[model samples]
Target: MALIKCSECGKEISDTVESCVHCGCPLGKVIFNTGNSWIGVFGKYIITDESGNVLAKLKENQQFEMNIVEDTTFYVQCNTSIRRNKVKVCVPAGEINKFLVKLGFLGIVTVVSKID
Candidate 1:
Protein backbone atom coordinates (compact mmCIF):
# COMPACT_ATOMS: atom_id res chain seq x y z
CA MET A 1 0.00 0.00 0.00
CA ALA A 2 1.36 3.37 -1.00
CA LEU A 3 1.32 6.10 1.57
CA ILE A 4 -0.42 9.28 0.53
CA LYS A 5 -1.92 12.26 2.22
CA CYS A 6 -5.57 12.17 2.95
CA SER A 7 -7.58 14.14 0.41
CA GLU A 8 -9.93 15.54 3.04
CA CYS A 9 -7.61 16.08 6.00
CA GLY A 10 -4.16 16.38 4.56
CA LYS A 11 -2.93 13.60 6.77
CA GLU A 12 -0.60 10.84 5.72
CA ILE A 13 -2.45 7.63 5.13
CA SER A 14 -2.16 4.47 3.14
CA ASP A 15 -3.91 4.43 -0.20
CA THR A 16 -5.14 0.91 0.47
CA VAL A 17 -6.77 2.02 3.69
CA GLU A 18 -10.50 2.30 3.75
CA SER A 19 -10.52 5.62 5.60
CA CYS A 20 -8.28 8.26 7.04
CA VAL A 21 -7.03 7.50 10.52
CA HIS A 22 -7.05 11.09 11.76
CA CYS A 23 -10.09 12.51 9.99
CA GLY A 24 -12.04 9.37 9.28
CA CYS A 25 -12.35 10.37 5.65
CA PRO A 26 -13.13 7.76 3.10
CA LEU A 27 -10.23 6.96 0.81
CA GLY A 28 -11.53 3.81 -0.82
CA LYS A 29 -8.88 2.52 -3.21
CA VAL A 30 -6.31 4.69 -4.85
CA ILE A 31 -5.65 4.15 -8.51
CA PHE A 32 -2.28 4.40 -10.21
CA ASN A 33 -1.74 4.29 -13.96
CA THR A 34 0.75 5.04 -16.64
CA GLY A 35 -2.01 6.33 -18.97
CA ASN A 36 -0.86 4.05 -21.77
CA SER A 37 1.63 1.23 -21.43
CA TRP A 38 1.91 0.25 -25.11
CA ILE A 39 4.52 2.92 -25.75
CA GLY A 40 6.50 2.97 -22.56
CA VAL A 41 9.59 4.57 -24.01
CA PHE A 42 8.65 7.68 -22.03
CA GLY A 43 7.49 6.75 -18.59
CA LYS A 44 4.47 8.46 -17.05
CA TYR A 45 2.35 8.07 -13.96
CA ILE A 46 -1.12 9.21 -12.95
CA ILE A 47 -2.44 8.85 -9.41
CA THR A 48 -6.07 9.16 -8.48
CA ASP A 49 -8.11 9.30 -5.33
CA GLU A 50 -10.77 6.92 -4.20
CA SER A 51 -13.49 8.90 -5.92
CA GLY A 52 -11.84 8.51 -9.29
CA ASN A 53 -10.44 12.02 -9.07
CA VAL A 54 -6.99 12.85 -10.28
CA LEU A 55 -4.51 13.57 -7.49
CA ALA A 56 -1.06 13.58 -9.02
CA LYS A 57 0.76 13.29 -12.33
CA LEU A 58 4.36 12.32 -12.86
CA LYS A 59 6.36 12.44 -16.08
CA GLU A 60 9.81 11.42 -17.12
CA ASN A 61 12.18 14.33 -16.95
CA GLN A 62 15.30 13.00 -18.63
CA GLN A 63 16.79 9.76 -19.83
CA PHE A 64 20.35 8.74 -20.63
CA GLU A 65 21.88 5.59 -21.89
CA MET A 66 25.35 4.40 -22.82
CA ASN A 67 26.53 0.98 -23.81
CA ILE A 68 24.84 -1.38 -21.34
CA VAL A 69 23.94 1.32 -18.85
CA GLU A 70 20.56 3.04 -18.82
CA ASP A 71 18.87 5.61 -16.67
CA THR A 72 15.31 6.97 -16.61
CA THR A 73 13.71 9.34 -14.19
CA PHE A 74 10.27 10.65 -13.35
CA TYR A 75 9.09 13.63 -11.36
CA VAL A 76 5.92 13.21 -9.39
CA GLN A 77 3.87 16.34 -8.81
CA CYS A 78 1.36 15.65 -6.15
CA ASN A 79 -0.68 17.66 -3.67
CA THR A 80 -2.18 15.05 -1.45
CA SER A 81 -0.03 11.96 -1.56
CA ILE A 82 3.21 13.79 -2.13
CA ARG A 83 2.77 16.69 0.27
CA ARG A 84 2.08 18.98 -2.65
CA ASN A 85 5.66 18.66 -3.78
CA LYS A 86 7.40 17.02 -6.67
CA VAL A 87 8.96 13.63 -6.09
CA LYS A 88 11.50 11.97 -8.32
CA VAL A 89 11.68 8.33 -9.29
CA CYS A 90 14.75 6.85 -10.93
CA VAL A 91 14.89 3.48 -12.62
CA PRO A 92 17.00 1.63 -15.11
CA ALA A 93 15.45 1.71 -18.57
CA GLY A 94 16.38 -1.85 -19.39
CA GLU A 95 14.80 -3.18 -16.22
CA ILE A 96 11.38 -1.98 -17.30
CA ASN A 97 11.88 -2.60 -21.03
CA LYS A 98 11.63 -6.37 -20.96
CA PHE A 99 7.88 -7.02 -20.99
CA LEU A 100 7.82 -7.65 -24.73
CA VAL A 101 11.18 -9.35 -24.63
CA LYS A 102 9.66 -12.01 -22.41
CA LEU A 103 6.88 -12.44 -24.94
CA GLY A 104 9.43 -13.55 -27.51
CA PHE A 105 8.91 -13.16 -31.29
CA LEU A 106 5.67 -14.13 -32.98
CA GLY A 107 6.80 -13.44 -36.54
CA ILE A 108 3.23 -12.56 -37.59
CA VAL A 109 1.40 -11.14 -34.56
CA THR A 110 -0.88 -8.16 -34.05
CA VAL A 111 -0.28 -5.77 -31.14
CA VAL A 112 -3.14 -4.29 -29.15
CA SER A 113 -3.00 -1.70 -26.44
CA LYS A 114 -5.87 -1.20 -24.05
CA ILE A 115 -6.81 1.37 -21.42
CA ASP A 116 -8.15 0.37 -18.03
Candidate 2:
Protein backbone atom coordinates (compact mmCIF):
# COMPACT_ATOMS: atom_id res chain seq x y z
CA MET A 1 0.00 0.00 0.00
CA ALA A 2 1.10 3.53 -0.71
CA LEU A 3 0.82 6.52 1.58
CA ILE A 4 -1.03 9.65 0.53
CA LYS A 5 -1.79 12.86 2.32
CA CYS A 6 -5.29 13.30 3.57
CA SER A 7 -7.02 16.13 1.74
CA GLU A 8 -8.97 17.22 4.76
CA CYS A 9 -6.30 17.12 7.46
CA GLY A 10 -3.09 16.76 5.47
CA LYS A 11 -2.07 13.63 7.36
CA GLU A 12 -0.33 10.79 5.69
CA ILE A 13 -2.50 7.73 5.26
CA SER A 14 -2.70 4.52 3.35
CA ASP A 15 -3.93 4.92 -0.19
CA THR A 16 -6.00 1.75 0.06
CA VAL A 17 -8.16 3.18 2.79
CA GLU A 18 -11.71 4.31 2.17
CA SER A 19 -11.54 7.31 4.43
CA CYS A 20 -8.96 9.47 6.08
CA VAL A 21 -8.03 8.27 9.55
CA HIS A 22 -7.16 11.72 10.75
CA CYS A 23 -10.14 13.65 9.44
CA GLY A 24 -12.60 10.93 8.43
CA CYS A 25 -12.97 12.41 5.00
CA PRO A 26 -14.39 10.11 2.40
CA LEU A 27 -12.28 9.11 -0.53
CA GLY A 28 -13.16 9.90 -4.11
CA LYS A 29 -11.71 9.15 -7.52
CA VAL A 30 -10.21 11.73 -9.83
CA ILE A 31 -9.61 10.93 -13.45
CA PHE A 32 -6.89 12.84 -15.26
CA ASN A 33 -6.74 12.77 -19.00
CA THR A 34 -4.65 13.92 -21.88
CA GLY A 35 -6.81 14.12 -24.94
CA ASN A 36 -6.19 11.79 -27.82
CA SER A 37 -5.51 14.67 -30.12
CA TRP A 38 -2.48 15.31 -32.28
CA ILE A 39 -1.40 18.27 -30.19
CA GLY A 40 -0.84 16.14 -27.11
CA VAL A 41 1.34 13.61 -28.90
CA PHE A 42 4.45 15.71 -28.74
CA GLY A 43 5.54 15.38 -25.13
CA LYS A 44 4.88 14.03 -21.67
CA TYR A 45 2.85 15.53 -18.89
CA ILE A 46 3.30 15.19 -15.15
CA ILE A 47 0.51 15.06 -12.64
CA THR A 48 0.95 16.04 -9.02
CA ASP A 49 -0.94 16.85 -5.92
CA GLU A 50 -0.85 20.09 -3.95
CA SER A 51 2.14 18.89 -1.94
CA GLY A 52 4.28 18.53 -5.06
CA ASN A 53 3.88 14.80 -5.02
CA VAL A 54 4.22 13.19 -8.42
CA LEU A 55 1.03 11.32 -9.03
CA ALA A 56 1.48 10.10 -12.58
CA LYS A 57 3.16 10.63 -15.93
CA LEU A 58 0.90 10.79 -18.95
CA LYS A 59 1.62 10.63 -22.61
CA GLU A 60 -0.60 11.46 -25.51
CA ASN A 61 -4.03 9.84 -25.37
CA GLN A 62 -3.23 8.56 -21.90
CA GLN A 63 -4.97 8.88 -18.58
CA PHE A 64 -4.31 8.55 -14.86
CA GLU A 65 -6.76 7.91 -12.10
CA MET A 66 -6.30 8.17 -8.38
CA ASN A 67 -8.13 8.12 -5.11
CA ILE A 68 -8.17 11.31 -3.11
CA VAL A 69 -10.21 12.88 -0.37
CA GLU A 70 -12.97 15.36 -1.19
CA ASP A 71 -12.22 18.94 -2.11
CA THR A 72 -8.66 18.64 -3.29
CA THR A 73 -6.56 20.25 -5.98
CA PHE A 74 -4.13 18.64 -8.38
CA TYR A 75 -1.46 20.17 -10.54
CA VAL A 76 -0.75 19.19 -14.11
CA GLN A 77 2.49 20.25 -15.72
CA CYS A 78 4.26 19.63 -18.94
CA ASN A 79 7.45 17.63 -18.50
CA THR A 80 9.98 19.59 -20.43
CA SER A 81 13.30 21.27 -19.97
CA ILE A 82 12.09 24.49 -21.52
CA ARG A 83 8.75 26.24 -21.95
CA ARG A 84 7.07 24.20 -19.28
CA ASN A 85 3.35 24.67 -18.83
CA LYS A 86 1.27 24.04 -15.72
CA VAL A 87 -2.37 23.97 -14.73
CA LYS A 88 -4.22 23.44 -11.47
CA VAL A 89 -7.39 21.44 -11.07
CA CYS A 90 -9.84 21.48 -8.21
CA VAL A 91 -11.70 18.22 -7.63
CA PRO A 92 -14.95 18.04 -5.81
CA ALA A 93 -16.54 15.24 -3.81
CA GLY A 94 -17.84 12.69 -6.25
CA GLU A 95 -17.16 9.48 -8.05
CA ILE A 96 -16.78 10.93 -11.50
CA ASN A 97 -14.37 13.79 -11.16
CA LYS A 98 -12.66 14.23 -14.49
CA PHE A 99 -10.03 16.67 -15.70
CA LEU A 100 -8.55 17.19 -19.11
CA VAL A 101 -5.09 18.45 -19.95
CA LYS A 102 -4.14 19.96 -23.26
CA LEU A 103 -1.39 21.95 -24.83
CA GLY A 104 -2.30 25.28 -26.39
CA PHE A 105 -0.41 27.78 -28.51
CA LEU A 106 3.30 28.10 -27.81
CA GLY A 107 3.21 24.92 -25.72
CA ILE A 108 0.93 26.46 -23.13
CA VAL A 109 -0.89 23.88 -21.06
CA THR A 110 -4.51 24.02 -20.05
CA VAL A 111 -6.63 21.95 -17.68
CA VAL A 112 -10.38 21.67 -17.89
CA SER A 113 -12.65 19.96 -15.39
CA LYS A 114 -15.30 17.85 -17.04
CA ILE A 115 -18.74 18.35 -15.62
CA ASP A 116 -20.99 15.39 -16.09
Candidate 3:
Protein backbone atom coordinates (compact mmCIF):
# COMPACT_ATOMS: atom_id res chain seq x y z
CA MET A 1 0.00 0.00 0.00
CA ALA A 2 1.19 3.49 -0.83
CA LEU A 3 1.49 6.17 1.80
CA ILE A 4 -0.61 9.24 1.20
CA LYS A 5 -0.98 12.51 2.98
CA CYS A 6 -4.20 13.25 4.72
CA SER A 7 -5.76 16.40 3.37
CA GLU A 8 -7.62 17.17 6.56
CA CYS A 9 -5.10 16.71 9.39
CA GLY A 10 -1.91 16.88 7.34
CA LYS A 11 -0.83 13.49 8.59
CA GLU A 12 0.53 10.51 6.73
CA ILE A 13 -1.70 7.50 6.17
CA SER A 14 -2.09 4.46 3.98
CA ASP A 15 -3.80 4.95 0.66
CA THR A 16 -5.98 1.93 1.34
CA VAL A 17 -7.48 3.57 4.35
CA GLU A 18 -10.88 5.11 3.79
CA SER A 19 -10.42 8.04 6.14
CA CYS A 20 -7.64 9.66 8.05
CA VAL A 21 -6.97 7.67 11.18
CA HIS A 22 -5.73 10.81 12.87
CA CYS A 23 -8.63 13.16 12.04
CA GLY A 24 -11.19 10.60 10.84
CA CYS A 25 -11.57 12.48 7.57
CA PRO A 26 -13.13 10.63 4.66
CA LEU A 27 -10.49 9.39 2.27
CA GLY A 28 -12.10 8.41 -0.97
CA LYS A 29 -10.67 8.06 -4.46
CA VAL A 30 -11.78 11.59 -5.21
CA ILE A 31 -9.57 12.81 -2.38
CA PHE A 32 -6.41 11.60 -4.09
CA ASN A 33 -4.15 14.55 -4.87
CA THR A 34 -7.11 16.86 -5.34
CA GLY A 35 -7.54 18.92 -2.20
CA ASN A 36 -6.45 22.52 -1.70
CA SER A 37 -4.40 22.37 -4.87
CA TRP A 38 -4.79 25.03 -7.52
CA ILE A 39 -6.44 23.15 -10.41
CA GLY A 40 -5.96 26.18 -12.67
CA VAL A 41 -9.13 25.53 -14.63
CA PHE A 42 -12.77 26.60 -14.84
CA GLY A 43 -15.88 24.81 -16.10
CA LYS A 44 -17.74 27.62 -17.86
CA TYR A 45 -18.97 31.19 -17.77
CA ILE A 46 -22.37 32.38 -16.65
CA ILE A 47 -24.46 34.62 -18.86
CA THR A 48 -27.86 36.28 -18.96
CA ASP A 49 -30.89 34.60 -20.51
CA GLU A 50 -32.23 37.49 -22.56
CA SER A 51 -32.01 41.23 -23.18
CA GLY A 52 -28.21 40.90 -23.00
CA ASN A 53 -28.06 41.70 -19.31
CA VAL A 54 -24.49 41.37 -17.98
CA LEU A 55 -24.75 39.10 -14.98
CA ALA A 56 -21.39 37.58 -13.96
CA LYS A 57 -18.08 39.17 -14.76
CA LEU A 58 -14.50 37.87 -14.97
CA LYS A 59 -12.01 40.62 -14.29
CA GLU A 60 -8.24 40.69 -14.64
CA ASN A 61 -6.09 39.53 -11.68
CA GLN A 62 -9.15 38.06 -9.99
CA GLN A 63 -9.19 34.40 -8.97
CA PHE A 64 -12.20 32.60 -10.42
CA GLU A 65 -15.00 32.22 -7.88
CA MET A 66 -17.16 29.48 -9.40
CA ASN A 67 -16.50 25.79 -8.83
CA ILE A 68 -15.38 23.89 -11.92
CA VAL A 69 -17.80 21.13 -12.78
CA GLU A 70 -18.40 18.73 -15.68
CA ASP A 71 -20.18 20.64 -18.43
CA THR A 72 -19.91 23.70 -16.27
CA THR A 73 -19.70 27.13 -17.90
CA PHE A 74 -19.12 30.70 -16.82
CA TYR A 75 -19.83 34.02 -18.44
CA VAL A 76 -16.46 35.40 -19.46
CA GLN A 77 -16.41 39.14 -19.81
CA CYS A 78 -15.52 40.46 -23.26
CA ASN A 79 -16.28 44.06 -23.76
CA THR A 80 -15.44 46.91 -26.13
CA SER A 81 -12.76 48.06 -23.69
CA ILE A 82 -9.07 47.71 -24.36
CA ARG A 83 -8.61 46.19 -20.91
CA ARG A 84 -10.33 42.96 -22.04
CA ASN A 85 -7.53 41.91 -24.32
CA LYS A 86 -5.90 38.48 -24.32
CA VAL A 87 -7.56 37.34 -21.11
CA LYS A 88 -6.37 33.91 -20.05
CA VAL A 89 -9.35 31.69 -19.36
CA CYS A 90 -9.16 28.40 -17.51
CA VAL A 91 -11.63 25.55 -17.76
CA PRO A 92 -11.67 23.13 -14.86
CA ALA A 93 -11.99 19.38 -15.15
CA GLY A 94 -15.26 18.08 -16.61
CA GLU A 95 -16.74 21.49 -17.42
CA ILE A 96 -15.23 22.66 -20.64
CA ASN A 97 -17.71 21.91 -23.43
CA LYS A 98 -20.80 22.53 -21.35
CA PHE A 99 -19.65 26.00 -20.51
CA LEU A 100 -19.05 26.83 -24.13
CA VAL A 101 -22.50 25.74 -25.25
CA LYS A 102 -24.37 27.54 -22.50
CA LEU A 103 -22.55 30.80 -22.81
CA GLY A 104 -22.31 30.63 -26.61
CA PHE A 105 -18.63 31.51 -26.35
CA LEU A 106 -17.69 29.29 -29.28
CA GLY A 107 -15.51 31.53 -31.37
CA ILE A 108 -11.99 32.45 -30.43
CA VAL A 109 -12.19 35.87 -28.86
CA THR A 110 -9.59 38.31 -30.07
CA VAL A 111 -9.10 42.02 -30.38
CA VAL A 112 -9.96 42.37 -34.03
CA SER A 113 -9.85 46.17 -34.15
CA LYS A 114 -9.59 48.36 -31.06
CA ILE A 115 -12.21 50.97 -31.73
CA ASP A 116 -10.80 54.05 -30.16
**Candidate 3 Cα misplacement greater than 4 A, ranges:** 30-116
- Model 3 agreement with the true structure over 1-116: per-residue lDDT tens digits: 77767766788887666567898776532100111222124522323323445445333222223322122222343443324333323333322122221111243342211111
RMSD of each: 16.3, 4.5, 14.7
lDDT of 2 by residue, 43-109 (tens): 6788888999998988878889877656778888876525565677888763558777766656554
Worst 10 residues of 2 by lDDT: 107-116
Q: Return the number of clashes found in candidate 2.
A: 0
Compute the lDDT for candidate 1. Answer: 0.36
A best-first ranking of the candidates according to their TM-score comes to: 2, 3, 1
Runs of candidate 1 exceeding 4 Å displacement: 30-116
In candidate 2, list every pair of residues with a backbone clash: none
The candidate that wins on TM-score is 2
* Model 1 lDDT per residue over 3-100, tens place: 77666678777655566779876543212233222323433344333344544544433222111122434333322222233333343322222111
TM-score of each model, in listed order:
0.26, 0.65, 0.26
The Cα local distance difference test for each model comes to 0.36, 0.73, 0.36
